[model samples]
Target: MDIRQLKYFVAIVDAGSLSKAAQKLYIAQPSLSQQMAALEDELETQLLLRSARGVKPTTAGHALYQRARAILRQMEQLRADVREDGGSESGMVAVGLPTTIAAVLAVPLFEHVRKHFPGIRLQIFESMSGYISEMLPDGRLDLAILFRDSETHGMSVIPAFDEELYVFGHAGLKLRKTATTCPLSALAGVPLVTPGTVNNLRLLIERTFLREEVELHIVGDIDSLPALMAIAHGGSACTILPASAMLHRAENARPPMRRIVAPDMSRPASVCWSHALPVSAAALAVRKAMVGLIGQLHADGRWPGITLRPPPDAATLEDTSGSV
Candidate 1:
C-alpha cells in the first residue's frame, strides 16, 4: 500500500535477490527483508518465493509485481510532473519500437529530443510491434513508435508515414518475380531470409506465401532489415524490406540490391500512446517532435512511395507547432 513497500518489492523483483535489491536500494538486507515480509503479511499472500534461480514471484506475486511496477512508474511520472518547474518539459521517457523501425528511427529521434529537450531522459528498446503494444497499456513506455495498428487498447494512434515494402536480392540470383510486384509463388524456390514469422512483416509475408502455396526457403531468420540486408546482399539468400530502409545507407560491402514486388506489399509507421492519462511534458514534446520529423522525412521524398497518416490530435494544437 505504501510507496516504500512497493518500491522495495519492485527492487527485489528486478534484482532477483534480497541482498542484491538491498544493495541497489542502499538499504540493509535485513531491513529490506522485513519490509517485504510486512507487505506480504498485509496482503495475506506470499509475494515472493526464494529459489536457487534467485527470488521468484509466485502466481500471486507475478500479478502483484506487474501492477506494482506500473504503479511505481506512474508515481515517478507524477513526481516528476509535480516538482519545481514541473510544468517545463523534463523527466524520462521509455520508448519502445520494433527492431527495424528502431534501427532506422530511434537514433535520429533521440538526437532531436536531446537537442530540443535536453532535460528529458531517453530509454530505448527494440521488440516487435505486438510487444510494444502490450507494454504501452501499462506505464512501461511513455510512447511507442511502431506499426501494425494500435493494440494499446485505450491508446491513440498517430500515423506518421507509410513505406512500400520491396523484395531485395543479389545480382547473380535470378529473381522469379518481376520488378513491378513480388508474387507469392515467386518465393517458392527462393531461399528466404526473413524475420521470425511472429513479427508483423514476416506474418504478412507468411500469409502471402500460404495464399500461393509457396514454401519460402528460409536460409536465415533475422529481426531487422539491416541485418537481413547484410546477409542477403552477400548472395546467401533473399529478403523483403521497406525501400526507405536502404535510402541512407552506404553501398553494401558485398553486392548491390534490386527491388522486388509481387504486385503489392506495404507498411506504415505509427506513434502510439495512451489517451486516458495526462503525459509528462517531456513525453508530449517528444511526440510532437517525432511527428514533425516523420513529416519531413516524407516531404524530402525519402519515403518515395509512401503515404503518411493524419497527424495526432486533430482538434488540439495545444501550444505545439512545427513541421519537417
Candidate 2:
C-alpha cells in the first residue's frame, strides 16, 4: 500500500522468513506480519506462501517485488540528485565484482570511493562473474565489472581491459618449467580443476582447446576461486585463471604461474550498468573512480597480465561526464 510496506515485503522475500526480516529491519515480528497482512489485504490477493520451512513469494508477489525494487531505486536516485544540487554527492552505490577481480580491485576501489567521495556509501558484492551479471539488469547493482563477452542486452558497457589467463599449480605438480610461457599442448594430459560449464571462463577455455585440437583433462569442476586455488595448492590438480586472482597472496605463498602460449589467451573486462534505470550521481562517481583506479593500477604495475583499454572517444566521454 505504501513504500514502507513494499520495503517490508521485499525484506521478507529476501530473508525468506518474517523473523529474519524483522531482525534485519529492527522491527517486531508481529508488527512486520501485520504490515504484510495489510499489504495483501490492500492488494486483494495472497502474496506470500507461508509454511514451516519459511516463505516464498507467489506469482503476484514476485511481480510486485520487481516493480517495488525499481520504484525504490528511482526514489534513491531522486534523493541523490537533490542532494547533489548543492555541489555534494551522497547516496548508496552498489558495485558487483567477480571473485578474481575482487582479489585485485575491491580494497583499492573501496578506499578510493571513501577518500574521494566521502559522502557516498559503497556496497561491494563479490561473487562469480556469471552470478554478478544476472544482478545488473534488475536494478540490484548500480554498476559491475563483467566479462566483455557476457550477455549485456539493454545495458551500457564500457570496455575496461584485457586480462591474460595462465596455468597455476604447486611445484609438486611437475609442470614443465618454461622460460616465459608454456605451450597449450604441454597441458594436454595434465589434470586440471576449473569452473563449471556455465561459467564464461570455462566456456572460453573449452572453445580454445577445441579450436586448437588439444585435449583438456579436467579432473574437477569447481566454481569457487578459493576451492580451485586450494586444489592446486595441494598438488592434486592445476587450475587456469587470470594472474589478478592471486594478487592477494604473498609472492612466496603463491603457486607457480605461467602464461599460456601456442596461441595466447585473454578475455576483456568491462564496466556495465542497466540502460533502463536512472543512474544516480553517486553511481556515476563510483564508476569514474573505478575506471581511474584501474588505470592507476595498470600504470603502477600492480595489476598483472592485464592491458588497459584506450581512453573513450570525445562523444563517449561527454556522455559519461556529469556534475559530480
Candidate 3:
C-alpha cells in the first residue's frame, strides 16, 4: 500500500525469513509480521507463504514484488533528479562495466567524474559482459556497457564501438611478426588461456572457431584478466581479447597483440539502459561523460584495435546523447 510496506515486503522475500528481514530492517519480528499482515489484509491477498524454512512469494506476491522494486527505484530517481547543489547536477548513478572495458574505463571514468561532476556520485559494477547485460533490464543498474547489440525489449541500446579480438602472447610464439593479422586456422593446436565458458567472450571465441572449422586448444580457463595476462606474459600460453586489455600493460613489457584474421571476428559494444524507467539527470550526465571519454580514447588511438561507432539516431537518442 505504501513504499514502507513495499520495502518490508521485498526485504522479507529477499531474506527469505521474517526474523532475518526484521533484523536487517532493525525492527522487531512481531512488528514486521504485523506490517506484512496489514499489507496482505489491505490487498485481500497473501503476499507471502510462510513455512518452517522461510517465506516465498506467491503469484500475486511475486507480481507486487516486481512492481514494488520498480516503483521504489523510480521514486529514488525522482528524488535524485530534483536534488541539485549550486546549480550543478547532484545524485547517485549506478553503471555497469564489462571486465575487459572496465580495465580501461574504470579509472578514467572515476577520475573524470571526480574532476568534473564532483557532486554526482558514481557506483561502478564490474563483471563479465553477460552479467552486465542481465542487470540492464532490472533497476539494479542505471546503465551498462554490453558487448553485443542484440535487441533487448524494454531497453534502449546505443552502439558504442567495435573492438577487434586479437591473439596476445609472448615473443616466443611461432606466429609471424611481420603481418598484423594471423589466419584463424593458425591458432589451431596452439595453447590458449581464456575465460571460462560462462563468459560471453569465451562463447564468442567458441562460436567463431565452430564457424571457421578450426579447433580451439584451450589450456587454461582463467576467469580473471590479470591472471590471463600473467599466464601470457610468463609464456605459459596465449590469450584472446580486445586490444584494450593489453593497452595499460604495454609500458610494463606486455606481450604482442596480433589481429585474428581469415574470417575476422569482432564484438560490438553498446550502452544500454531501461526504457521502462525514467532517466534521471545525473544518469544522463554520467552517460554523456562516458560517451565523451570513449570518443577521446578512440580519437587518441590509445584504445587500440577499436573503432568508435556512430551514435544511435535521434529517435533512440532519448534523454542523453551518450552512446555505448
User: In terms of lDDT, which candidate is strongest?
Assistant: 2
Which TM-score value belongs to model 2? 0.87
What are the C-alpha RMSDs, in order, of all predicted structures? 4.8, 3.2, 4.4
Weakest 10 consecutive residues, lDDT, candidate 3? 315-324
- Which is the better candidate, 1 or 3, if ranked by TM-score? 3
lDDT per residue for candidate 2 within 1-324, as digits (tens), equals 899998999899879899999999999999999999999999999999999999988999987876777678767767766767843667888899999999888999999888888889899999988888877765578789999834345777778899999988843244555546777887787889899888889999999999999898898999899888877777788899999878887676677788888889999998887764566667777888888889998899989899888866646433442212
At residue 149, candidate 2 shows an lDDT of 38
* Candidate 1 global CA lDDT score: 0.71
Error of 1 at 210 (Å): 1.5
- Cα lDDT listed for each candidate: 0.71, 0.82, 0.80
> Model 2 residue 200 lDDT?
82
- Please provide the root mean square deviation of candidate 3 (C-alpha atoms, Å): 4.4
* Pairs in steric clash, model 1: 181-261, 181-262, 181-263, 182-261, 182-262, 182-263, 183-262, 192-217
Candidate 3: C-alpha lDDT: 0.80
